[model samples]
Target: MFWFVDGEKSEYSGGRTAVEIKSWCTEMTGPAVKEISSRKLAEEQAGTKPICVYEGPEASTDFEEIAARKRTEFTFYHVAVDTEKPTVSVQHKSEEPVACDDLTFDGLKKCLDDNTLPLFGVLDGETYEKYMTSGKGLVWACLEMESSDDLEKVADEYRPLIKEVAEEFKDQFAFLYIDTIQFKRFLEGVLGVTELPTLAVNKKAGDKLKYLYTGEMTAPKVDEFLKNVLDGSIEPTLKSEPVPSSQDEPIHVVVGSTLVEDVFQPDKDVLFEVYAPWCGHCKRLAPEYEKVAKKVAEAGLDDMVVLSKMDGTANDSPVESISWEGFPSLFYVKAGETEPIKYDGPREAEGMWEWIEEHHSNSEGLKERVAAGKAVHEEEDSEADKGEEL
Candidate 1:
C-alpha cells in the first residue's frame, strides 16, 4: 500500500509501504498506543492515518470476542477490483446440521445489494445497521462449545443435514433453516434443545418470535410436522403469524384499535360471524370462531366478511357495529352496506357458519365444489319433492 504522494515533490524518492491503522480502547490499549502515537511526532512518520479512539468496555461475556472485534489488524493485500465495494458472505458455524433455506448469509446480502439501488453494499449495510442500532425485529442465536475446535467439527457434520431438510420443505410454504446462528436459535428458542441434531421452527409474530417446534431433525419428520400444523392436526401451542388469512396473500394481523375503514362489499351473498372475546357465548363459541375464521377463508371471502372483531364495549363502540342480542352474533353483511342481515342464532362459530347455509340457501363456497348451478340443499329439495308426491 503505497502512500499518495505529490508529483512535484522530486526530492522524495518514493512513498512508504502499507501503514497499519491502530485504535486503542480504554480497556485494552493504554501503554502500547501511547508508544505508537509518540513515534508519529517525527517528520519521517508522516502520511499515516491511524484512527485511534478510546472505546469503553462493552457489556460482553467473552473477552476473546471483545478482543477479536477491537483487534482488527488489516494487512494491505494486493487484489484487483474496479470498485471500492465491500463484499460479505455468511458462514454458519454449527454442530447440528443446517438447512439450506436457513443458510441466508449470502443471499440476504445479495438481495439487499441488488435492491439498494446503485448503493450495492451500502444499502445492505444500512439495513443491517438499522437492525443493529434500533434492535427492531432482531434475532440473535448463539451456541457454546467446549472449544472453537468442537464448534468447527459440529459445523462440518450438521451443514449437509440442514441442506437436505431445507430442500424437502422448499416447495412447501414454511421457512425451515438449521445453520450456525439459526441452529443455535433453534436450540435456545425451543428451550434448551437436548438432542444432538435439533431443528427448530420459528415464525415471526408481532414483536416476538413464536416457536413452532424443536426436536429431532429429519426431512420426513419435519414434513409431517409442517403438514400437521397446516391441517390443524397440531394446535400450535404458541400462536404463529396466523397462517395465510387469504390465499396467495400476506397475512394481516388485527392490531388493537384498528377500525375496518376499507369496506369490501361482496357482490354475492356473504356470511360473517361477529365475535367478541368478552361475550360468554363467544367463549362457548371459541372453537366455533376458529371454524368461522377458516370457513370464511375457505369460502374465499377474500373481500367478503372482512374478518373483523369490532369491540362492542359501551365505552368503545367500533363503527356502529350492532351487538349480538343473541348468544353467537351470526350476521351476513351485504357488500357496500353499513348493515348486515342478522342471522340470529346461538352465538357460536359453527352456528355463525351454519346460519348462512340455512338462511341464504345459496352456498357461495359450495358452488365452487359442486357444479356451477347445482342445488345448495339437495337433501332438503328431495324431501320437499317427496312431500309433494305424498
Candidate 2:
C-alpha cells in the first residue's frame, strides 16, 4: 500500500526539502524495491526520489561452527549494492483531541464523555458519561451506505457528482467517504437505497435508521432527505430495495423480523450465522468476518452496512432462526425471496468474497456483511461488554 505523508519517518533519511519515497524488502525479497527495473520509475511514479532498505539474511552460527571445528559458512550479502546507512530521529506522531465531528475512535469516546446534548455519527470510541449524568440524550449514527464501485467508477459512472456533493456537505456534516467495495454490499438487494449515495441514521440498537440521504448528494438533495427523515416527513425505507442488478446477491437470510420483506439487514443476517455457530464452518469463518468489519470501518462505510454480530455458540446469543438448510449454505436475497449461493466449506473471506463477487452485492466485495456481523457478535458477547450492544 502507498502512504503519503508530508513529513519524514525514522526509516527515511532524506532531507525535508526534497520529496522522497522509501521502500523495504524482507530477506526473501532481497531489498525493498530491488526487483524494480529502474529506481527512476519508482521515483517518477511517486513524484519523489526513491530509496530502498534491506536487512541481509544472517545464517552463520560462528560460535557453533567453531565448537564443531567446522568452517563458519555464511549467507550474508547474497544481494547487496550498498553498505552505507544513516540514522535519523523523527518525532512520534501525536494524536489530537477528538472533536465532536472527528469520526475517529478517539473522537467517539470523547463525545460520549463530553456531550450534554444528542450526539450522532458515533464511531468506535465511547463513554457512559451522558446516560449517567443527564439520562435523556442519545448518541446517533448517520452513516452512508457502502457503494459497489471504486472511487473512480463512482466518479465516472455511478455517481459522478459525489465529489461536488461531498464538498458541499463538508461543513454541514461529517461526510465519511467509502469506496466501491463497500457500495457493492450496499447495492445487493433492495434497501430502498436505489440511488448511489445512501445515508442511515440510528439511535438505538434494534432500530433501523429512520433518517436517510440518497441519490446525487447535492446540497439541496442532502437537505431534502435529511429534512424529511429527521422531521418525520419521510418514512424510513423499511421495504425499500436498491435498483435491481444483473449480479448475484448474498444469502439474504432474515432473522428477528419475518422474511416478510427482503433487504439483508444486520440483525437478520447474523441470524444465519448464529443459528449454526458450532458448525465447523461457522467457526472457520471467524477471521473472514473480521476482515469485513475492519474494511468497512477503514473505508468509513461502517454506518451504511450496519454490520452487527451474534454468536450461535452462546446460550444468550443464538441464531434466532434455524435455516438448517441454509446452514453451511450461502444465498443471494432480493425483494422477498432468498436464493441459496454455493459455499465450498466453512464461511471464509476468500470463499465468501468469491461468492459475493459472483452472486449478490458488488463483485468488488468491499463490505463483508457476514464477517462484520460475526465480529460484532464477538465483540459484544465478550465478557466485558456483554451487556452493551454496539
Candidate 1 segments exceeding 4 Å error: 1-278, 298-306, 318-330, 346-351, 358-390
- The Cα local distance difference test for each model comes to 0.36, 0.34
Segments in model 2 whose C-alpha atoms lie over 4 Å from true places = 1-150, 156-172, 176-183, 186-218, 230-235, 239-390
Q: How many backbone clashes does candidate 1 have?
A: 9
Worst 10 residues of 2 by lDDT: 87-96
Per-residue CA lDDT of model 2 for 152-208, tens digit only, reads: 333343232433443343223332223424444443321234444465433232233
lDDT for 277 (candidate 1): 52
In candidate 1, what are the lDDT values of residues 178-236, reduced to their tens digit? 23343455344333344444433323212222224455556576657765654556642
Quick one: best lDDT, which candidate? 1
